[model samples]
Target: MANIMLTKDQWDALQRHLLPNPFKVEEAAFLFVKVTESGDFECVDSWCMQPHDFDYQSAFHISLRDETKAAVIKRAHDTGTALVEAHSHLGKWPAEFSRSDLCGFDSFVPHVRWRLKGKPYAAIVLTTADYDGFAWIGDATDPVRIDGLVIGDVDRLGPTGLTPLTWGPWEDFDGHI
Candidate 1:
Protein backbone atom coordinates (compact mmCIF):
# COMPACT_ATOMS: atom_id res chain seq x y z
CA MET A 1 0.00 0.00 0.00
CA ALA A 2 1.41 3.34 -1.05
CA ASN A 3 0.74 6.79 0.36
CA ILE A 4 1.03 10.41 -0.59
CA MET A 5 2.79 12.84 1.71
CA LEU A 6 2.01 16.52 1.75
CA THR A 7 3.27 19.37 3.85
CA LYS A 8 0.64 21.23 5.87
CA ASP A 9 0.77 24.21 3.57
CA GLN A 10 0.54 22.05 0.46
CA TRP A 11 -2.49 20.22 1.78
CA ASP A 12 -4.19 23.47 2.75
CA ALA A 13 -3.61 25.01 -0.67
CA LEU A 14 -4.89 21.93 -2.45
CA GLN A 15 -8.01 21.82 -0.29
CA ARG A 16 -8.76 25.45 -1.02
CA HIS A 17 -8.55 24.89 -4.78
CA LEU A 18 -10.61 21.71 -4.78
CA LEU A 19 -13.36 23.01 -2.49
CA PRO A 20 -13.69 26.67 -3.19
CA ASN A 21 -16.70 28.52 -1.79
CA PRO A 22 -19.68 29.11 -4.04
CA PHE A 23 -18.67 25.67 -5.28
CA LYS A 24 -21.55 24.97 -7.57
CA VAL A 25 -19.57 22.80 -9.95
CA GLU A 26 -16.75 20.31 -9.87
CA GLU A 27 -13.12 21.39 -10.08
CA ALA A 28 -9.95 19.65 -11.24
CA ALA A 29 -6.24 19.92 -10.59
CA PHE A 30 -2.97 18.10 -10.98
CA LEU A 31 -0.52 17.50 -8.19
CA PHE A 32 3.05 17.07 -9.32
CA VAL A 33 4.73 14.48 -7.13
CA LYS A 34 8.13 12.95 -6.77
CA VAL A 35 8.24 9.18 -6.52
CA THR A 36 10.43 8.61 -3.49
CA GLU A 37 12.84 5.67 -3.30
CA SER A 38 10.55 4.20 -0.64
CA GLY A 39 7.70 4.17 -3.25
CA ASP A 40 5.62 6.95 -1.69
CA PHE A 41 4.49 9.98 -3.62
CA GLU A 42 5.77 13.23 -2.19
CA CYS A 43 3.95 16.34 -3.24
CA VAL A 44 6.10 18.89 -5.02
CA ASP A 45 3.51 21.35 -6.23
CA SER A 46 0.05 21.62 -7.79
CA TRP A 47 -1.61 23.18 -10.79
CA CYS A 48 -5.26 24.03 -10.36
CA MET A 49 -7.10 23.90 -13.63
CA GLN A 50 -8.83 27.14 -14.39
CA PRO A 51 -12.24 27.55 -16.02
CA HIS A 52 -10.81 28.01 -19.45
CA ASP A 53 -8.87 24.78 -19.12
CA PHE A 54 -11.99 22.71 -19.57
CA ASP A 55 -13.80 22.12 -22.81
CA TYR A 56 -16.96 21.11 -20.99
CA GLN A 57 -18.06 21.29 -17.38
CA SER A 58 -21.16 20.75 -15.29
CA ALA A 59 -21.89 20.07 -11.67
CA PHE A 60 -21.25 16.40 -12.37
CA HIS A 61 -18.60 16.33 -15.08
CA ILE A 62 -15.76 18.09 -16.80
CA SER A 63 -13.51 17.58 -19.85
CA LEU A 64 -10.19 19.24 -20.13
CA ARG A 65 -9.24 21.15 -23.22
CA ASP A 66 -6.54 19.48 -25.30
CA GLU A 67 -4.18 22.39 -24.76
CA THR A 68 -4.66 22.20 -21.06
CA LYS A 69 -3.82 18.53 -21.07
CA ALA A 70 -0.81 19.15 -23.23
CA ALA A 71 0.52 21.83 -20.95
CA VAL A 72 0.30 19.68 -17.86
CA ILE A 73 1.90 16.75 -19.60
CA LYS A 74 4.70 18.93 -20.83
CA ARG A 75 5.39 20.25 -17.39
CA ALA A 76 5.45 16.79 -15.88
CA HIS A 77 7.78 15.54 -18.58
CA ASP A 78 10.18 18.40 -18.16
CA THR A 79 10.25 18.19 -14.41
CA GLY A 80 10.41 14.38 -14.21
CA THR A 81 7.44 14.27 -11.87
CA ALA A 82 4.56 11.87 -11.64
CA LEU A 83 1.07 13.29 -11.93
CA VAL A 84 -1.84 12.69 -9.63
CA GLU A 85 -5.11 13.88 -11.07
CA ALA A 86 -7.48 15.30 -8.49
CA HIS A 87 -11.07 16.37 -8.87
CA SER A 88 -14.01 17.36 -6.73
CA HIS A 89 -17.44 15.85 -6.43
CA LEU A 90 -20.40 17.89 -5.38
CA GLY A 91 -22.47 16.92 -2.36
CA LYS A 92 -21.47 14.02 -0.12
CA TRP A 93 -20.90 11.07 -2.39
CA PRO A 94 -18.26 8.56 -1.35
CA ALA A 95 -14.98 9.37 -2.97
CA GLU A 96 -14.89 6.47 -5.35
CA PHE A 97 -14.36 6.50 -9.06
CA SER A 98 -17.53 6.54 -11.09
CA ARG A 99 -17.99 4.09 -13.99
CA SER A 100 -17.42 6.94 -16.38
CA ASP A 101 -14.15 7.61 -14.66
CA LEU A 102 -12.94 4.04 -15.09
CA CYS A 103 -13.80 4.05 -18.73
CA GLY A 104 -11.91 7.23 -19.31
CA PHE A 105 -8.89 5.82 -17.54
CA ASP A 106 -8.79 2.87 -19.90
CA SER A 107 -7.78 5.23 -22.63
CA PHE A 108 -6.23 8.18 -20.86
CA VAL A 109 -4.00 6.24 -18.55
CA PRO A 110 -2.40 4.28 -21.32
CA HIS A 111 -1.88 7.39 -23.37
CA VAL A 112 -0.30 9.22 -20.47
CA ARG A 113 1.99 6.35 -19.66
CA TRP A 114 3.13 6.17 -23.24
CA ARG A 115 3.73 9.90 -23.35
CA LEU A 116 5.59 10.00 -20.10
CA LYS A 117 7.61 6.89 -20.96
CA GLY A 118 5.98 4.96 -18.14
CA LYS A 119 6.06 7.21 -15.13
CA PRO A 120 3.40 6.19 -12.62
CA TYR A 121 -0.01 7.86 -12.79
CA ALA A 122 -2.73 8.23 -10.22
CA ALA A 123 -6.16 9.76 -9.72
CA ILE A 124 -8.08 10.89 -6.68
CA VAL A 125 -11.70 11.79 -6.24
CA LEU A 126 -12.73 14.07 -3.41
CA THR A 127 -15.89 15.29 -1.76
CA THR A 128 -16.24 17.66 1.16
CA ALA A 129 -15.65 14.88 3.69
CA ASP A 130 -13.73 12.07 2.06
CA TYR A 131 -11.19 11.05 -0.53
CA ASP A 132 -10.24 7.84 -2.33
CA GLY A 133 -7.46 7.21 -4.77
CA PHE A 134 -5.41 4.61 -6.65
CA ALA A 135 -2.10 4.50 -8.39
CA TRP A 136 -0.38 2.49 -11.12
CA ILE A 137 2.96 1.42 -9.73
CA GLY A 138 5.88 0.02 -11.71
CA ASP A 139 4.52 -1.63 -14.88
CA ALA A 140 1.46 -3.24 -13.35
CA THR A 141 -1.65 -3.55 -15.45
CA ASP A 142 -3.91 -2.86 -12.46
CA PRO A 143 -3.74 -0.09 -9.92
CA VAL A 144 -3.35 -0.41 -6.18
CA ARG A 145 -5.50 1.58 -3.83
CA ILE A 146 -3.71 4.53 -2.33
CA ASP A 147 -3.75 3.49 1.30
CA GLY A 148 -3.28 6.72 3.21
CA LEU A 149 -2.50 10.40 3.24
CA VAL A 150 0.13 12.10 5.31
CA ILE A 151 -0.81 15.67 6.05
CA GLY A 152 1.97 17.31 7.98
CA ASP A 153 2.63 14.91 10.84
CA VAL A 154 -0.81 13.27 10.89
CA ASP A 155 -1.20 10.06 8.88
CA ARG A 156 -4.84 9.57 7.87
CA LEU A 157 -5.95 6.31 6.39
CA GLY A 158 -8.12 6.14 3.32
CA PRO A 159 -11.76 5.12 3.60
CA THR A 160 -12.26 1.48 4.39
CA GLY A 161 -13.54 -1.15 1.88
CA LEU A 162 -11.55 -0.08 -1.16
CA THR A 163 -9.73 -2.92 -2.88
CA PRO A 164 -7.30 -2.93 -5.75
CA LEU A 165 -9.04 -3.22 -9.12
CA THR A 166 -8.53 -2.97 -12.84
CA TRP A 167 -10.23 -0.24 -14.80
CA GLY A 168 -11.52 -1.31 -18.12
CA PRO A 169 -12.10 -1.59 -21.78
CA TRP A 170 -15.65 -0.31 -21.64
CA GLU A 171 -17.11 1.14 -24.77
CA ASP A 172 -18.94 4.44 -24.98
CA PHE A 173 -18.01 6.06 -21.69
CA ASP A 174 -18.80 9.74 -21.48
CA GLY A 175 -16.39 10.74 -18.75
CA HIS A 176 -15.70 13.60 -16.40
CA ILE A 177 -12.34 15.30 -16.51
Candidate 2:
Protein backbone atom coordinates (compact mmCIF):
# COMPACT_ATOMS: atom_id res chain seq x y z
CA MET A 1 0.00 0.00 0.00
CA ALA A 2 1.05 3.57 -0.59
CA ASN A 3 0.44 6.94 0.94
CA ILE A 4 -2.67 8.85 -0.06
CA MET A 5 -2.25 12.50 -0.92
CA LEU A 6 -4.99 15.06 -0.51
CA THR A 7 -4.76 18.70 -1.44
CA LYS A 8 -5.28 20.93 1.55
CA ASP A 9 -8.58 22.14 0.20
CA GLN A 10 -9.82 18.63 -0.44
CA TRP A 11 -8.71 17.54 3.00
CA ASP A 12 -10.40 20.47 4.71
CA ALA A 13 -13.60 19.96 2.77
CA LEU A 14 -13.76 16.32 3.77
CA GLN A 15 -13.06 17.16 7.39
CA ARG A 16 -15.76 19.81 7.42
CA HIS A 17 -18.36 17.56 5.83
CA LEU A 18 -17.60 14.68 8.16
CA LEU A 19 -17.04 16.61 11.40
CA PRO A 20 -19.79 19.22 11.38
CA ASN A 21 -21.99 17.54 14.00
CA PRO A 22 -19.28 15.73 15.89
CA PHE A 23 -20.71 16.77 19.22
CA LYS A 24 -23.76 14.67 18.52
CA VAL A 25 -24.17 11.08 17.42
CA GLU A 26 -22.02 9.56 14.71
CA GLU A 27 -22.56 10.62 11.12
CA ALA A 28 -21.06 9.13 8.02
CA ALA A 29 -19.80 10.64 4.78
CA PHE A 30 -18.21 9.24 1.65
CA LEU A 31 -15.72 10.58 -0.87
CA PHE A 32 -14.89 9.32 -4.35
CA VAL A 33 -11.64 10.95 -5.23
CA LYS A 34 -9.77 10.97 -8.51
CA VAL A 35 -6.79 8.79 -7.76
CA THR A 36 -3.42 8.27 -9.44
CA GLU A 37 -1.45 5.23 -8.32
CA SER A 38 1.94 5.43 -9.93
CA GLY A 39 4.46 5.51 -7.09
CA ASP A 40 1.79 6.18 -4.51
CA PHE A 41 -1.84 7.15 -4.24
CA GLU A 42 -2.76 10.74 -5.03
CA CYS A 43 -6.24 12.23 -4.81
CA VAL A 44 -6.50 15.35 -6.90
CA ASP A 45 -10.22 15.93 -6.74
CA SER A 46 -13.13 14.48 -4.76
CA TRP A 47 -16.86 13.96 -4.66
CA CYS A 48 -18.48 14.13 -1.23
CA MET A 49 -21.15 11.61 -0.41
CA GLN A 50 -24.56 13.21 -0.60
CA PRO A 51 -27.64 13.13 1.64
CA HIS A 52 -29.59 10.80 -0.64
CA ASP A 53 -26.89 8.17 -0.61
CA PHE A 54 -27.84 7.35 2.96
CA ASP A 55 -31.26 6.42 4.23
CA TYR A 56 -32.27 5.88 7.87
CA GLN A 57 -28.70 5.41 8.92
CA SER A 58 -27.33 5.51 12.46
CA ALA A 59 -24.56 7.01 14.48
CA PHE A 60 -22.79 3.69 14.69
CA HIS A 61 -23.24 2.54 11.10
CA ILE A 62 -23.90 3.64 7.54
CA SER A 63 -25.47 1.98 4.53
CA LEU A 64 -25.62 3.18 0.97
CA ARG A 65 -28.56 2.69 -1.29
CA ASP A 66 -27.96 -0.12 -3.76
CA GLU A 67 -28.30 2.33 -6.59
CA THR A 68 -25.75 4.65 -5.07
CA LYS A 69 -23.34 1.76 -4.77
CA ALA A 70 -23.90 0.66 -8.34
CA ALA A 71 -23.53 4.18 -9.69
CA VAL A 72 -20.26 4.78 -7.91
CA ILE A 73 -18.88 1.51 -9.14
CA LYS A 74 -19.90 2.27 -12.69
CA ARG A 75 -18.41 5.75 -12.50
CA ALA A 76 -15.18 4.41 -11.10
CA HIS A 77 -14.98 1.88 -13.87
CA ASP A 78 -15.64 4.44 -16.57
CA THR A 79 -13.38 7.12 -15.12
CA GLY A 80 -10.65 4.84 -13.80
CA THR A 81 -10.18 5.92 -10.23
CA ALA A 82 -9.92 4.31 -6.86
CA LEU A 83 -12.96 4.36 -4.58
CA VAL A 84 -12.79 5.43 -0.98
CA GLU A 85 -15.60 4.67 1.45
CA ALA A 86 -15.27 6.91 4.50
CA HIS A 87 -17.35 7.56 7.59
CA SER A 88 -16.88 9.11 10.99
CA HIS A 89 -16.27 7.73 14.46
CA LEU A 90 -17.85 10.37 16.65
CA GLY A 91 -16.64 9.45 20.11
CA LYS A 92 -12.86 9.13 20.06
CA TRP A 93 -9.77 10.87 18.77
CA PRO A 94 -7.89 7.71 17.84
CA ALA A 95 -10.84 5.56 16.95
CA GLU A 96 -10.68 1.84 16.59
CA PHE A 97 -12.10 -0.01 13.60
CA SER A 98 -15.07 -1.85 14.99
CA ARG A 99 -15.86 -5.49 14.31
CA SER A 100 -18.99 -4.16 12.70
CA ASP A 101 -16.83 -2.32 10.18
CA LEU A 102 -15.02 -5.48 9.22
CA CYS A 103 -18.21 -7.46 8.75
CA GLY A 104 -19.62 -4.72 6.56
CA PHE A 105 -16.57 -4.62 4.31
CA ASP A 106 -16.05 -8.34 4.06
CA SER A 107 -18.55 -8.27 1.26
CA PHE A 108 -18.96 -4.64 0.21
CA VAL A 109 -15.35 -3.78 -0.61
CA PRO A 110 -14.79 -6.80 -2.78
CA HIS A 111 -17.97 -6.17 -4.71
CA VAL A 112 -16.92 -2.60 -5.38
CA ARG A 113 -13.56 -3.80 -6.63
CA TRP A 114 -15.20 -6.28 -8.94
CA ARG A 115 -17.42 -3.62 -10.37
CA LEU A 116 -14.52 -1.27 -10.96
CA LYS A 117 -12.60 -3.94 -12.85
CA GLY A 118 -10.19 -4.36 -9.95
CA LYS A 119 -9.65 -0.72 -9.17
CA PRO A 120 -8.62 -0.21 -5.57
CA TYR A 121 -11.21 0.07 -2.83
CA ALA A 122 -10.57 1.68 0.53
CA ALA A 123 -12.52 1.90 3.76
CA ILE A 124 -11.76 4.82 6.05
CA VAL A 125 -13.02 5.76 9.49
CA LEU A 126 -12.34 9.25 10.71
CA THR A 127 -12.43 10.91 14.11
CA THR A 128 -12.25 14.56 15.11
CA ALA A 129 -8.46 14.65 14.83
CA ASP A 130 -7.36 11.54 13.00
CA TYR A 131 -8.44 8.45 11.07
CA ASP A 132 -7.93 4.75 10.46
CA GLY A 133 -8.21 3.29 6.97
CA PHE A 134 -7.21 0.32 4.87
CA ALA A 135 -7.11 -0.58 1.19
CA TRP A 136 -7.80 -3.70 -0.78
CA ILE A 137 -5.31 -3.59 -3.63
CA GLY A 138 -6.12 -7.11 -4.67
CA ASP A 139 -9.05 -9.49 -4.34
CA ALA A 140 -8.26 -10.61 -0.82
CA THR A 141 -10.63 -10.51 2.15
CA ASP A 142 -7.94 -8.75 4.20
CA PRO A 143 -6.52 -5.32 3.37
CA VAL A 144 -3.18 -3.65 3.48
CA ARG A 145 -3.30 -0.57 5.67
CA ILE A 146 -2.82 2.81 4.05
CA ASP A 147 0.64 4.27 4.47
CA GLY A 148 -0.26 7.86 5.34
CA LEU A 149 -2.22 10.90 4.33
CA VAL A 150 -0.02 13.70 3.09
CA ILE A 151 -1.26 17.19 3.86
CA GLY A 152 1.14 19.78 2.53
CA ASP A 153 4.52 18.63 3.81
CA VAL A 154 3.48 16.65 6.88
CA ASP A 155 2.61 13.00 7.02
CA ARG A 156 -0.40 11.85 9.06
CA LEU A 157 0.90 8.32 9.08
CA GLY A 158 -1.34 5.27 9.11
CA PRO A 159 -0.90 1.63 9.91
CA THR A 160 1.06 0.49 6.88
CA GLY A 161 4.16 -1.34 8.04
CA LEU A 162 3.73 -0.54 11.72
CA THR A 163 0.93 -0.42 14.24
CA PRO A 164 -1.55 2.42 14.21
CA LEU A 165 -0.38 5.52 16.01
CA THR A 166 -1.63 6.15 19.52
CA TRP A 167 -2.85 9.51 20.70
CA GLY A 168 -1.24 11.00 23.75
CA PRO A 169 -3.12 12.83 26.52
CA TRP A 170 -4.78 15.84 25.05
CA GLU A 171 -6.26 19.13 26.21
CA ASP A 172 -9.90 19.53 25.41
CA PHE A 173 -9.32 23.18 24.62
CA ASP A 174 -6.28 24.64 22.98
CA GLY A 175 -5.70 28.06 24.37
CA HIS A 176 -2.70 28.68 22.18
CA ILE A 177 -3.00 28.00 18.49
Candidate 3:
Protein backbone atom coordinates (compact mmCIF):
# COMPACT_ATOMS: atom_id res chain seq x y z
CA MET A 1 0.00 0.00 0.00
CA ALA A 2 1.08 3.57 -0.58
CA ASN A 3 2.25 5.43 2.47
CA ILE A 4 0.18 8.31 3.85
CA MET A 5 2.09 10.87 5.86
CA LEU A 6 0.32 13.09 8.31
CA THR A 7 1.97 15.90 10.19
CA LYS A 8 1.46 16.19 13.94
CA ASP A 9 -1.22 18.83 13.35
CA GLN A 10 -3.09 16.90 10.72
CA TRP A 11 -3.19 13.76 12.82
CA ASP A 12 -4.45 15.71 15.81
CA ALA A 13 -7.12 17.44 13.74
CA LEU A 14 -8.51 14.15 12.45
CA GLN A 15 -8.48 12.55 15.87
CA ARG A 16 -10.53 15.37 17.28
CA HIS A 17 -12.93 15.54 14.35
CA LEU A 18 -13.60 11.79 14.18
CA LEU A 19 -14.25 11.17 17.84
CA PRO A 20 -16.56 13.79 19.21
CA ASN A 21 -17.70 11.27 21.79
CA PRO A 22 -14.71 8.99 22.05
CA PHE A 23 -16.36 6.76 24.61
CA LYS A 24 -19.79 6.49 23.05
CA VAL A 25 -20.61 3.30 21.17
CA GLU A 26 -24.19 4.16 20.30
CA GLU A 27 -23.38 5.11 16.67
CA ALA A 28 -20.52 5.06 14.27
CA ALA A 29 -18.85 8.32 13.22
CA PHE A 30 -17.66 9.34 9.76
CA LEU A 31 -15.42 11.91 8.09
CA PHE A 32 -13.58 12.61 4.86
CA VAL A 33 -9.98 13.80 4.80
CA LYS A 34 -8.48 15.33 1.70
CA VAL A 35 -4.79 14.90 1.24
CA THR A 36 -2.16 16.08 -1.18
CA GLU A 37 -1.55 14.22 -4.43
CA SER A 38 -0.26 10.74 -3.67
CA GLY A 39 3.31 11.58 -4.61
CA ASP A 40 3.47 14.31 -1.95
CA PHE A 41 1.67 12.14 0.64
CA GLU A 42 0.35 14.76 2.99
CA CYS A 43 -3.00 15.45 4.59
CA VAL A 44 -4.67 18.80 3.83
CA ASP A 45 -8.25 19.29 4.98
CA SER A 46 -10.87 17.19 6.74
CA TRP A 47 -14.64 17.29 6.75
CA CYS A 48 -16.43 15.73 9.69
CA MET A 49 -20.02 14.64 9.48
CA GLN A 50 -22.29 15.21 12.41
CA PRO A 51 -24.54 12.43 13.67
CA HIS A 52 -27.73 14.18 12.72
CA ASP A 53 -26.57 14.37 9.09
CA PHE A 54 -26.63 10.62 8.63
CA ASP A 55 -29.50 8.70 7.15
CA TYR A 56 -28.63 5.55 9.00
CA GLN A 57 -26.67 4.95 12.20
CA SER A 58 -26.03 2.37 14.88
CA ALA A 59 -23.22 1.00 16.95
CA PHE A 60 -21.96 -1.02 14.01
CA HIS A 61 -23.32 0.76 10.95
CA ILE A 62 -23.60 4.17 9.31
CA SER A 63 -24.88 5.72 6.12
CA LEU A 64 -24.29 9.34 5.18
CA ARG A 65 -26.71 11.47 3.30
CA ASP A 66 -26.38 11.44 -0.47
CA GLU A 67 -25.48 15.11 -0.34
CA THR A 68 -22.60 14.50 2.03
CA LYS A 69 -21.12 11.91 -0.29
CA ALA A 70 -21.48 14.29 -3.19
CA ALA A 71 -19.81 17.05 -1.24
CA VAL A 72 -16.79 14.89 -0.58
CA ILE A 73 -16.47 14.02 -4.26
CA LYS A 74 -16.71 17.67 -5.20
CA ARG A 75 -14.00 18.68 -2.78
CA ALA A 76 -11.57 16.13 -4.18
CA HIS A 77 -12.39 17.14 -7.71
CA ASP A 78 -11.90 20.80 -6.97
CA THR A 79 -8.63 20.36 -5.11
CA GLY A 80 -7.01 17.70 -7.29
CA THR A 81 -6.43 15.56 -4.22
CA ALA A 82 -7.20 12.09 -2.92
CA LEU A 83 -9.75 11.42 -0.22
CA VAL A 84 -9.69 9.14 2.80
CA GLU A 85 -13.10 8.20 4.10
CA ALA A 86 -12.73 7.22 7.74
CA HIS A 87 -15.15 5.99 10.35
CA SER A 88 -15.15 4.82 13.94
CA HIS A 89 -15.30 1.31 15.46
CA LEU A 90 -16.41 2.55 18.91
CA GLY A 91 -14.34 0.66 21.47
CA LYS A 92 -10.99 -0.82 22.36
CA TRP A 93 -11.34 -3.60 19.79
CA PRO A 94 -8.93 -3.32 16.89
CA ALA A 95 -10.44 -1.43 14.02
CA GLU A 96 -10.89 -2.99 10.59
CA PHE A 97 -13.49 -2.58 7.92
CA SER A 98 -16.56 -4.63 8.73
CA ARG A 99 -18.56 -6.79 6.28
CA SER A 100 -21.15 -4.13 5.66
CA ASP A 101 -18.43 -1.50 5.41
CA LEU A 102 -16.77 -3.49 2.63
CA CYS A 103 -20.08 -3.99 0.88
CA GLY A 104 -20.81 -0.30 1.00
CA PHE A 105 -17.33 0.49 -0.26
CA ASP A 106 -17.74 -1.82 -3.23
CA SER A 107 -20.82 0.10 -4.22
CA PHE A 108 -19.46 3.64 -3.86
CA VAL A 109 -15.65 3.65 -3.89
CA PRO A 110 -15.32 3.01 -7.61
CA HIS A 111 -17.62 5.88 -8.35
CA VAL A 112 -15.74 8.15 -5.97
CA ARG A 113 -12.47 7.25 -7.67
CA TRP A 114 -13.88 7.92 -11.09
CA ARG A 115 -14.98 11.35 -10.00
CA LEU A 116 -11.65 12.18 -8.39
CA LYS A 117 -9.75 11.58 -11.66
CA GLY A 118 -8.72 8.13 -10.51
CA LYS A 119 -6.74 9.40 -7.55
CA PRO A 120 -6.28 6.91 -4.73
CA TYR A 121 -9.06 6.49 -2.18
CA ALA A 122 -8.83 4.89 1.24
CA ALA A 123 -11.03 3.60 4.05
CA ILE A 124 -10.06 3.62 7.69
CA VAL A 125 -11.79 2.15 10.74
CA LEU A 126 -10.56 3.98 13.80
CA THR A 127 -11.08 3.07 17.43
CA THR A 128 -10.21 4.95 20.59
CA ALA A 129 -6.89 3.16 20.72
CA ASP A 130 -5.95 2.22 17.14
CA TYR A 131 -7.00 1.88 13.51
CA ASP A 132 -6.67 -0.26 10.39
CA GLY A 133 -6.69 1.04 6.84
CA PHE A 134 -7.04 -0.14 3.25
CA ALA A 135 -6.68 1.62 -0.07
CA TRP A 136 -7.60 1.16 -3.71
CA ILE A 137 -4.40 2.30 -5.33
CA GLY A 138 -5.21 1.36 -8.92
CA ASP A 139 -8.54 -0.32 -9.45
CA ALA A 140 -7.70 -3.77 -8.09
CA THR A 141 -10.61 -6.10 -7.25
CA ASP A 142 -9.57 -5.80 -3.63
CA PRO A 143 -7.74 -2.97 -1.88
CA VAL A 144 -4.06 -2.93 -1.05
CA ARG A 145 -3.76 -3.48 2.69
CA ILE A 146 -2.07 -0.83 4.79
CA ASP A 147 0.48 -2.78 6.75
CA GLY A 148 1.27 -0.05 9.23
CA LEU A 149 0.30 3.48 10.16
CA VAL A 150 2.61 6.30 11.23
CA ILE A 151 1.33 9.56 12.56
CA GLY A 152 3.80 12.20 13.61
CA ASP A 153 3.89 12.87 17.37
CA VAL A 154 0.74 10.83 18.07
CA ASP A 155 2.11 7.42 17.02
CA ARG A 156 5.81 6.99 16.59
CA LEU A 157 7.67 3.74 16.03
CA GLY A 158 10.95 3.06 14.33
CA PRO A 159 11.01 0.85 11.20
CA THR A 160 11.36 -2.40 13.14
CA GLY A 161 8.68 -1.36 15.54
CA LEU A 162 6.30 -1.04 12.60
CA THR A 163 6.98 -4.31 10.72
CA PRO A 164 6.35 -7.71 12.22
CA LEU A 165 6.16 -11.38 11.35
CA THR A 166 2.37 -11.28 11.39
CA TRP A 167 -0.38 -8.70 11.71
CA GLY A 168 -3.32 -9.40 13.99
CA PRO A 169 -6.89 -10.49 13.05
CA TRP A 170 -7.78 -7.25 11.28
CA GLU A 171 -5.00 -7.81 8.79
CA ASP A 172 -6.13 -11.42 8.22
CA PHE A 173 -9.82 -10.62 8.03
CA ASP A 174 -11.61 -9.79 4.78
CA GLY A 175 -15.32 -9.94 5.42
CA HIS A 176 -16.17 -9.00 1.85
CA ILE A 177 -15.12 -12.37 0.54
| Backbone clashes under 3 angstroms, per model | 1, 0, 0
- Which pairs clash (backbone N, Cα, C closer than 3 Å) in model 3? none
**Worst lDDT window (10 residues) for model 2?**
160-169
**Tens-digit lDDT string for candidate 3 (1-177):** 555567777667777766665445423323344444543245666776777668776676678889878877887787777887777767666565666676677669889888877777776677777777777776574676654446774564212121121233445655333
Candidate-wise lDDT, in order: 0.83, 0.66, 0.64
lDDT tens digits, residue span 85-146, model 2: 77776775475566556656766877777777777777677788677778777655567788
lDDT score at residue 11, model 3, on the 0-100 scale: 69
Query: Candidate 3: which stretches are off by over 4 Å?
Result: 25-40, 153-177
Which portions of model 1 miss their true places by more than 4 Å? 160-164, 167-169, 172-177
Candidate with the larger TM-score of 1 and 2: 1
Cα RMSD of predicted structure 3: 5.7
What would the TM-scores of all predictions be? 0.91, 0.79, 0.75
Q: For residues 84-169, could you state the per-residue lDDT of candidate 1 as single tens digits?
A: 89988888766777776777677788888888999888888888888888888888867888877888887575743342386545
